[model samples]
Target: MSTKEFIKNQVEKFSSHITPEEFADLTEAENSLIILEVPSKDYTLTEIARIIESNNAHVMSLSVLPVSDGSTLLISIKLDISDLTPVLRSFERFNYNVIYYYMKEGEINDIQRERLQELLFYLNM
Candidate 1:
């Protein structure tokens, strides 16, 4: 399946327990954010954020999932298309293992965009 389709499926699957409105909110957050599953042993979320920020990217949110060996981090970052390469390279320079799967803001659909706007509105309220 295509990346968008995969993302949609993942969102739907993960949001099943929530109400429709909550699901929409979760989907919007997922769409607007780029998800990075970074293994924790290499770098902490703060270090990753600092590395990205130094390279001119902005991190919006961060979470961690504990695993057996280390941990996995879910990071949402904002970066211009042009800055993607440099930011990725910076991660490599630090020997950070960034998982291949990720979502980009531009990949989100219109419905997701509307949801994102709504979610942002609620956050600002």
Candidate 2:
């Protein structure tokens, strides 16, 4: 089976056990989560870590789930940094198939926050 098919099958099974809110809560944690697929022959923990480190990030935890087809493995990684934009781009540049990723929503930008504060002061609410 192709990699996509295997990944799809696994995700389907996994989704049945968790609701969207539950899943969101899981991803909204301090650490970011990334799910990728790699050919069994090309899988290497060191290589993945090196790639993440290149973006000044570190992997908090990693789990490897072997597909039933035995051709590709799904790599689930939790990163210490919540901003996943840089890490996602780095993985794409390296040609890794990023199947899923979740980053906790960032707070309002400084300018936006300041504007809101000024408005609130005027309203005195």
Candidate 3:
């Protein structure tokens, strides 16, 4: 199977045991996502929306946590499943710190938390 099929299958499997809240978080919208670890700034929201648009995604919701030096932003994006990797590549090229997880997979999963921790350990806490 193609990678997209593999990913969709994996997400489907992961969703099976998820709680209602988690399920809502993951599949509320077909192209929905949660992005975390973005720098805090007055224009951060506008910038994030722009980024999503540039990647051919749409912003649905956003949450923010402020730290001493920067703010972490959680953005919900609506995008095509096939566009995930390319969108991620754009984020990388722009130096936008990003952490993404489906709501279901991210809801209190030790494995998911550990993996994300490993990936973002160096990011400012």
Candidate 4:
């Protein structure tokens, strides 16, 4: 098999152990960057802003990445708690490519790092 397949296969073999402490670390505000993947062509800033306001969140920073298939947007929200479920559910109504993350602050252990690397591969980032 190819190296990519090999790595994915190996990554699937290991189970991740995330403690409450680790989960807390993931939601910590200091060094987290929230990733939002959405369809860029049909989406406007107004729609994005509406979604944020509807969910009672405000945007701090926004970055847009264009790809052949579709575009992905990264938003840094200055939120007390990094809760993405509401925002994601609201965005789903528009039928866009969506996923989110609050980037971990401290050094990512091997498993977390590997999972992120796998994400990069899948997203072609």
Q: CA lDDT, every prediction?
A: 0.52, 0.73, 0.52, 0.50
- The 10 consecutive residues of candidate 1 with the worst lDDT sum are 74-83
Clashing pairs in 1: none
Query: Judged by TM-score, which candidate is best?
Result: 2
- In candidate 4, what are the lDDT values of residues 1-125, reduced to their tens digit? 43334333322321125443364465443223344555555757787778766877666545554444445333333333355556656767766544444433332355578998999999995
User: Can you tell me which runs of candidate 1 are displaced by over 4 Å?
Assistant: 1-42, 69-83, 101-125
Residue 88, model 4: Cα distance from true site in angstroms: 1.6
Candidate 3 on 1-125: residue-level lDDT in tens? 43334334444544467643465555645443445455545436666667667867665545444444444333334343323554566777877765655532222456667888988976855
Error of 2 at 105 (Å): 3.4
Error of 3 at 73 (Å): 5.2
Clashing pairs in 3: 40-71
Better of 2 and 3 by lDDT: 2
Candidate 3 to native Cα RMSD, angstroms: 13.3
Per-residue lDDT tens digits for candidate 1, residues 1-23, read 43344445444554466643464
lDDT of 2 by residue, 1-125 (tens): 55566555545443447753355466533356788989999998998999999998888667688877888899978776766787888888989999987665433255568998999999996
**Where in model 2 is the C-alpha error above 4 Å?**
1-30, 106-125
The TM-score measured for candidate 1 stands at 0.44
lDDT of 2: 0.73
